[model samples]
Target chain A: MATTKTPSRLVLNGLLNENPIFRLALSMCPAVGISTTVMNGLMLGTAVLFVQVCSSCTIAAIKNYIHPRIRIPTYTLTIATWVTVIDLVLSAYAPEAYKAMGIFIKLIVAFAIITMRLEVFACKNTVAMSFWDGLGMGLGFMFGMVTLGFIRELLGMGTLLGHNVLGFRPLLFFALPLAGFFCVGFMMAIFNYVELVFNRRKKRRG
Target chain B: MARLRRITYLTLGFLLLAYLLVFSGCAGSQNRFIKKTSFRGTHSILITFAGPVDEEWATKASNYRVYEKPDPDIVLKISTIELSTNRQTVILHFEEPLNQNQPHMVTMRGIMTEGKSVGTAIVKVRKLYLGYLFSILIGAMLVQNFVFTKYLGLCVFFGTSQKRSTAVGMGVTFTIVIVASAMMSWFLYQFFLKPFHLDFLQIIVFIGLVSLSVQAVDTILRKVNPMLFKAFGVYLVLVIANCIILAVPLILADNEYNAAESLMLALGAGLGFLIALFLMSSVRERLELANVPPTYRGLPIAFVVAGLFALAFLGFSGMSIF
Candidate 1:
């Protein structure tokens, strides 16, 4: 699979086809939980991106040594260790963001997307490929989270990353968990629709 | 092959033994049963039990003795020992007002529950407001719902909600697993982690316990009732990865809730998930027949409906139930 796919394709796959939150619908917990504000979403996404890349790179490097029978636990321990390290660092250095995102950060250890990447791509791929895959997937997650965060923040609070955008009272519902579903759903629809039209135009011209 | 099987069995047996030893060792410690003491008011301090105490044993005034520490002369007599309806909380009424500045030692000797002795427990009273438990419940259910509010288990939330039957099954399973795991995790956190100052390891420990219990439940269900297991087995396995199961304990620990409050929060959160799933599934069933654009079909439409539902649920906010 890695042989056929170019590095750019892999990156694009992560950002588009296999986008963890929007396309594959993985890790929606943090996406909804922390995406009430753009800052919260960005911070949580950064944490996940860091953990995902580190875990991917490490798993790729050590895939040969891991026993098949115990691979799941080993992978889980790896994610947990990285999450813990990030948790400690965030709490010590970025105390305010840590206060807002502490619980969500701890939850990164159990995200299926991270484990899925390790099992599906990282374990079998080269270290360099795995790094790219990780980066793409992580960036994809960050993009989805930030998008959701941006929408929710804009609608709910009439603000974007703490700046007052709208002068009136916001919908307020967009800030809630229920609206997260709506925002993602509509965004997904628009995304697919545009892709469809884009493909149609390309086909007609060709 | 036989040797390998033997080795596997031996390893499994050793792991079980170690788990038992650690759990029993933690339970054996006096600190396990006695949680913390808090001032409910000027005259009373609420002593929380880690688990439900025997109502009969708890009601008996002679079982509990409170003394102002370092001052035997200031013996505070128990006026009334009120066991909460949940059976986890025991509100001790004292004749003499507790001094806010001084500390009090509560001793429960041989508190028997369900034909077994819980042994002795001694805890120092600390300043904790009891009024927040209600807010925690409302907040967990309505304000910070695991599904609609926090988005803990969206995979299951969206995956099972297409069919009403599956949604209900998932809801029941989720409620049971979440509440049970929350209680178990609380016990593990309080008795094991708190005593050892291993609080930082909570995330790993809580997730491990949740996954292990889910596995245990799956196996036991398969053995005892194959039909029920067959219906919910796949969903149960999927639940191990469900964020809500892990989130309950994490939220409970983050908020520093006692056993009773943790149970309530768990129940509330689970109920919230159940309500959200049921609503979404029912709406989707209707949505299936509705004419829609190609792009807005299926999950995208379901999400839009869910957003509307979320908007409806937002009405529950700002409600001062307490």
Candidate 2:
């Protein structure tokens, strides 16, 4: 795996094969909680991206310095610092998004994505490679959240980013919790379908 | 010695941080963000009831004004008379006073009846912050219940409902964690985020706090009560990811609850969550043995069961118990 070091594969894998929400299905808290709006999805995805990349780099760079027993603590501290920085900035500048996204932003500390990457990629890879992996994973999360938000917003309110894209009629139930389940389930199905197609195409070519 | 020292240092750090938070008034709303609504001329007595009732009753009681458009100014003397299967009781308390003689409509939301069946009570609120807290709790917890309203966290609802004992235990456990974690998270947000201008880290902080707290609880449980720890070890770990825990703090922070109000809301929300989970779990436990299923073995069938239970919960939203 280390010898392969394929950036394109890393990027593609993060988006699809190893997608944070769809494939791995970790971090459902934020996925379900914040997918009410596209802007929320975007902001949270960006924040997670920042934390994921920075923490991945730190973990890779300090792979040797960290004691096996204390690796979790060190990773936590590193992640916490970055989270603190992001939380402060969001509250100061984008108070609404901060408020809307709420505890999910702070939840980045325990998000399985960061720790998973550390255990899987960052621990074994170079700092630069870890950064790219983080980016790929972050983008994957962004894709999942944005898609969930889009489906939810569209069906729930007949709007995208608070705009009336689908005209005057809106499905009231779409804004309800059931709508969230429907949207997420629908996206997961779509993800599986796309994965199936992509895999089939790859098999045929090979 | 090293482990003890580390524990001491971390505990002290959290306590000091908490002290600074309280000193700075960052733990909550600091009694700010109170907005008054237009009041009606009549003395809008906010009458709440037990469980879910007909909307027609509420509309008739408040003369339909409360149902149509909420008037902001009338001082609402809120009370409830709950009639349950066990007995009938009335519980009363004081809310913030309203601007006198202002035209306002009273709406009945659910309130804690203190384990009583039928209860009647009146509450008056004068402070804007208390009013804000009161309204938000009503809106978020009862009116639009996270369990009933948003229908979030149903996964745990089904997951923990295998037995009556586990259901009750999980319900109580969830309540404790929810109340404690919500308060802590609110404090962290108020003190850490606002003053230091580190509010952007709210999610990371909250997640960190929850994960650490859950892990700490797991460690302490293992050491102190190994039997109890072994019983619900897996459940305890799973609670870390429970969306209810995460959602509550987010709601509290967004609402800007003061310490006292935040605590109350947490208690209420936790109770509400427990109520929902325990009820569903009990029902699901009974349904476990008797089932006709070929395709719908696990999650899919659980979803359908949950949808039915969710429908039942929706009935309670109309309860005039506030």
User: Clashes per prediction?
Assistant: 0, 66
- Per-residue lDDT of model 1, residues B230-306, tens digit only: 77688886786688887788877776766666766877787788788888889889888899899998778877786
Q: Using lDDT, give the best candidate's number.
A: 1
- Compose the digit string of candidate 2's lDDT tens values, residues A73-131: 56767887888888788989999888887667766765767777887889888998998
Chain A TM-scores of all predicted models: 0.91, 0.90
Q: For residues B65-127, could you state the per-residue lDDT of candidate 2 as single tens digits?
A: 222223444434444322324322222222444443222333333323343322222233222
* Cα-lDDT of candidate 2: 0.63
DockQ, each predicted model? 0.52, 0.16
Residue A147, candidate 1: C-alpha displacement in angstroms: 2.3
Give the worst 10-residue stretch by lDDT in candidate 2 chain B. B26-35
Q: Which docking class does model 2 fall in?
A: incorrect
What ranges in model 2 sit over 4 Å off?
Answer: A1-5, A92-103, A106-110, A157-165, A168-170, A189-206, B1-144, B147-169, B181-212, B243-260, B279-320
Best by DockQ: 1
Give me candidate 2's TM-score against the actual structure.
0.62
What DockQ does model 1 achieve? 0.52
| lDDT of residue A198 for candidate 1 | 94
